[model samples]
Target chain A: MKKIALGLLQVAGLTVFSLLVNTLTSLLHIPLPGSIIGMILLFLLLESGVIRLNWVEVGASWLLAELLLFFIPSAIGVMKYSKLLEADGLQVLAVVLVGTFAVMAGSGVLTGAIYRIKERRSS
Target chain B: MITGLLFLGLTIAVYLLAKRIYASSGKMYTSPLIITPLLIIAFLLMTGSSYESYNAGGKWLSDLLQPATIAFAIPLHKNFKVLKKHAAEIAAGVLSGTVIAVISSMLLAKWLHLSGDLATSLVPRSVTTPIAMSISQSIGGVPSITAVFVILTGVLGTMMGPSVLRLFRIDNEIARGVSLGTAAHGTGTSKAFELSSLTGTISSIAMILTALFSIGLAPALIAVFLH
Candidate 1:
């Protein structure tokens, strides 16, 4: 019973915080993403020790554990565009495949190289 | 009512299958990010139902994205020190990588004479799905196409990241995390967590940096190149 109540409270707290950040961002016309703003707010609260790590962990883990479940609706949006996909399916696939590889390779190599340079300079 | 129940059951089943596959493979290839979509695709193929119908029930699931995205702060907070230390280099790497991703892909598509629609579709390929979809819509690209590309990019990054890291002998946790996050977004960041907590933390920061950088840069690049 205690654990369940605590869990519920954590969820409520997170939701409230999320709403607050989002509301503030919109009201103030902040250019950052609402979720990003929420994240930053959560970080500040945690860092300030207003919300302990344990308090946030239960709810955070639950959210992260099923993260991909949240994307189903958007992924299913693919159905609405099936006709468009069929029309340019091959081209889309080619671009995705090639473009994905390019970013992965380019970013990975560059990050790795720069990190090495930084390590040498620091050491 | 019956249709809703059926759709809910299907979503859970697919999620379970994805988790099981991930457990068995011990590799990022079978991540829920990859499996869920594939399973959903298979379900659609078998049922012949439109995405709209599936989404009718799936929207409940998508609502969780808000909290899940917020949870990223936990990891980010934990890694504040590491983030501060490498902040400059990490920022530069993410910014450059994002610009190169959008510009190079657009140029490549143009050189190949791909259609404008397809060119726009590829414009947001490096960002996460939600932002990518928005960018696609604003730039007259097909949102669904961008979503598929975003997922594919994430899956490819999650699957190939470690191998590429090993090949290049890049073993730093910060480097690994940022690279994965920048290239793959949340999906790759999840995989980064599996390798090490530090890697996961760094990846979360990378995900944010890449998203922000791309969102700010993509519109300008699209206007200049695709317009």
Candidate 2:
């Protein structure tokens, strides 16, 4: 029960943090979403030692692990576009799959190459 | 209020059941995210229930996405020290990955003669759900379609990333994580976490940096090709 309360409190903290970030982003008229801004804010808070990592780790991990729940509504909204799907679903899925692999390959190769170069230069 | 509660309970129950089947069944297509929504979508169709009613419940649940996205900083912070050591090299790798993902999606859509809105929506398909959804919004893409695309990309990335990495002869854990995270976001990050905490940390960082870079890049591309 205490653990549940702690988890709830930790999530509450995250909500407060995200709300503040959203407000700040709106006030500053930043193009970025407030959630992304809140991510940065929390990072800075952790780095600055203002917030200990363990305090929120459990709740945060649970939320991230179940993150897809947040997107299900948006995904279900796809029901509204059956005509488009009947016409283009295969092409869209093909592009997304190909693009996903291309990205994984590109980033992996580049990071490995850079690390190798850095290692050689150092030695 | 009762209807709202009913819809909410149904959605969660379907989601939990999907997870159970996925875990016990060892089936690939039964991912909770994919299957649960499919089930709900189908159920709605059968019952002639309104999307508005379903969303009435889901919108409130999805509001947690904001907090979830922010709370991501916890894992990120836990893994920061490791990331700081190779920050520059990793950043460049992630930037290149994000560029390839965005550019390729745009080009593929163009090759297929997709519309401007269709092409634009595909641009942010590789980022995490929340950021991808929002980026799609800012770029005048359909967020629902873009969310579907993002989740699809993530699922494919998690499934295929390791094999693709091997094909490229890239074996570094940091590279693996960075690539997956940059390419796939939360789904990829989850796969990385399964590998090791260090890799997961790097993936988380890559996911954030990729979103940051994409947010800045998508609009310029939108101006050039979308409108």
Q: List runs of model 1 lying over 4 Å from the truth.
A: A1-9, B27-29, B137-144, B223-227
> Candidate 2 residues A1-123, lDDT tens each?
988888888888888878888889999998778987888888888889998888888789878777767767776877877788789988887888888888888888899888888889989
lDDT of 2 by residue, B1-227 (tens): 66667878888889888878978985657777678878888999999988888887878777888898787687777777777878987899999988887789888998988888888888999888767888999888888788878877876776676678778887788898899899988778877876777787788789989998998887886566644
How high is the lDDT of residue B107 in model 1? 83
> Per-model C-alpha lDDT, please?
0.76, 0.82
* Candidate 2, DockQ score (0 to 1): 0.68
What TM-score does each of the candidates earn?
0.88, 0.88
Cα deviation in Å at residue B141, candidate 1?
Answer: 3.3
Residue B59 accuracy (lDDT) in model 1: 74
Docking level of model 1: medium
Best by DockQ: 2
lDDT tens string, model 1, B10-65? Answer: 88788888888888987666777666777777878798876667767777677667
TM-score of 1: 0.88
State the displacement of the C-alpha of residue B152, model 1, in Å, after optimal TM-score superposition: 3.0
Q: Which stretches of candidate 2 lie over 4 Å from their true place?
A: A116-123, B25-27, B133-144, B162-171, B219-227
